[model samples]
Target: MSNSQFSEERFQQAPVVGILRGVDHATLDRIIPIYINAGFSTIEITMNTEGATNMIQKLSEEYPQLNVGAGTVCDMDDLEEALKYGAQFIVTPITNEAIIRKCKSLNIPVFPGALTPTEIYKAWTAGATAVKVFPSSQFGIGYIKDVMAPLNKIPLLPTGGVTLENIADFFQAGVTGVGMGSSLFPKQFLKEGFEQQLFDHLKAVKSAYESVFQTA
Candidate 1:
């Protein structure tokens, strides 16, 4: 595939991806557009989200331009269901080769979670497009630089504890991109009746990234 056709290329350039963890079907219809307008063409809905499979199907059909991924996924059954419901990407909190292989067979991007260098290497060898650096604050940017020094070939997506405040630091530290949840969630938007606050925050992150990475 050409660079123009790969999600990795697009994701890297986007500079940020919106992670909608623990979302429910009730609020999704109103929430998805908030993400779309936030300069986020990619979205991740955790498996534990209420009516996740149904929401994935609906979101995929509604926003054809968005890359909808299934997150917090663990087993083969969840993977199969997620794919059937139109998940464009599959992400897990662990390095499970089975889920990785299934996603590969289906030609979708797979990002398995890893904390240690050994686990990160194993995920990369298993054909993961990228390995998610979970609880990024727990390890910090130094851990990312340390890992990349040796396995520079691997693209790392640092997730967890990724607030808008600290996200730029992670990107500057060489992360492919950051996956954020609570930080990205606009609580006031839902209450104040203006969804644009959330959108603006996302755009702000993109702007920060552009200032740093010329290509972004």
Candidate 2:
């Protein structure tokens, strides 16, 4: 029950957030334990996905040790609905001051998506728990390293482009953590009975991350 707002603390211990998009209830319920077994301490279900709120609620109730939250939340309504459904945290692809403030008042951590330095700064200043660099693959890890040169004080969570192959590199480049999706949960891996394969893939990613960071 640490909640998603405690990401800074919990994420540092694991540093990987599983992003599950377009997954239904049964599918998510089955695959999520595999993710947890593979060492992901947090899971995010995108709001754009059907039945996302219910998924969050179910996971929160079922997986008390893991932090569950909502992603792709675009507006205040999405934010409100997500919280109502027991989302412990909120993530948006765009910086919305109103939504950020609302989340703050509710004591939930918010990670707003931003691309440019200006937007990143604005989000950070608006009390974003962290700024998620979406489509981070477009700029590459070099961009993250370069951006962190001056803004190193702010916590940056690079998503969208971070893969198992380059995840260690992103951390080396100063990203506090990463939000990974398809790379971790491929479509084929979501099929019934693919749980072991999915678990192995996630295990490999976690192993590689440990090798790179030497955290423990």
Candidate 3:
């Protein structure tokens, strides 16, 4: 599917994009199914993590229905490797026009990170699938509201600062979705056998999103 189609589908169902940073092979094998079962349609595995590419491959092969993507992609090499490993989408921590264009050329959806309005606009105009507000917690709801007031046409995803308590507020503030990490998958849930606990936590998070977005 095209980036727009993938994003639209995700928006229609679940807008939570799980970010697995520093997750190893074993941890991924344990948590991936849990994420899918919890109703997260998209996941981003940071490229800097050890065995990230391998993990991406594993997730892509094991869960072909999920949108497995590459995150923290800083350069072309990372993008190429991610695509080779079957990354369905691409996300960068910084607004790199070159990388965005490259992904665009390949028809891969890319969410490049940006902080200021200038950076966000540049990334959006450069063809980013959507602009990710990095360290969004630092900006707070006020900043997000202010930004969206003017750039509502561009889809914004708050990454870094998204918590279970504030997910609804962020969505209310006009974010297309969120990039959630520790808040959704804490270390305790990654233990040898925490499937039930993990599922319960994810269910709560999903509840929070549904309460606000009211997905059918």
Those runs of model 2 whose alpha carbons end farther than 4 Å from true positions after fitting are: 1-8
lDDT of 3: 0.85
- Candidate 3 residue 11 C-alpha distance from true site, Å: 5.2
Q: Tens-digit lDDT track for model 2 on 1-216?
A: 324344456667788778999888789779878888787788899999998888888888878777888999999889888988888888899999998888888779899999899999999999898899887978989999888999999999999888878888887777877888999888998999888999989988887777766763
For candidate 1, write residues 1-216 as lDDT tens digits: 111122565565584667776666656777777667666777888899888888777878777767788898899989888888888888899999988887787678888999899999988888898899887868777888888898888899988877766676777777777787777776665543566676677678767766667655
lDDT of each: 0.77, 0.85, 0.85
CA shift at 182, candidate 3, in angstroms?
Answer: 1.1
Model 3 Cα lDDT, one tens digit per residue, 1-216: 222223457644888789989877888888888888888789889998999888888777777668888899999999889888888889999999999998898888899999999999999999998899998978888899999888889999889878878888888777888898888889898888898999889988888878875652
Which residue runs does candidate 1 get wrong by more than 4 Å? 1-9
lDDT comparing candidate 1 with the true structure: 0.77
If scored against the real structure, what TM-score would every candidate get? 0.90, 0.94, 0.93
Q: Who is ahead in TM-score, 1 or 3? A: 3
- Backbone clash tally (model 2): 0
Candidate 3 displacement at residue 34 in angstroms: 1.2
Give the Cα-based TM-score of candidate 1 against the true structure: 0.90
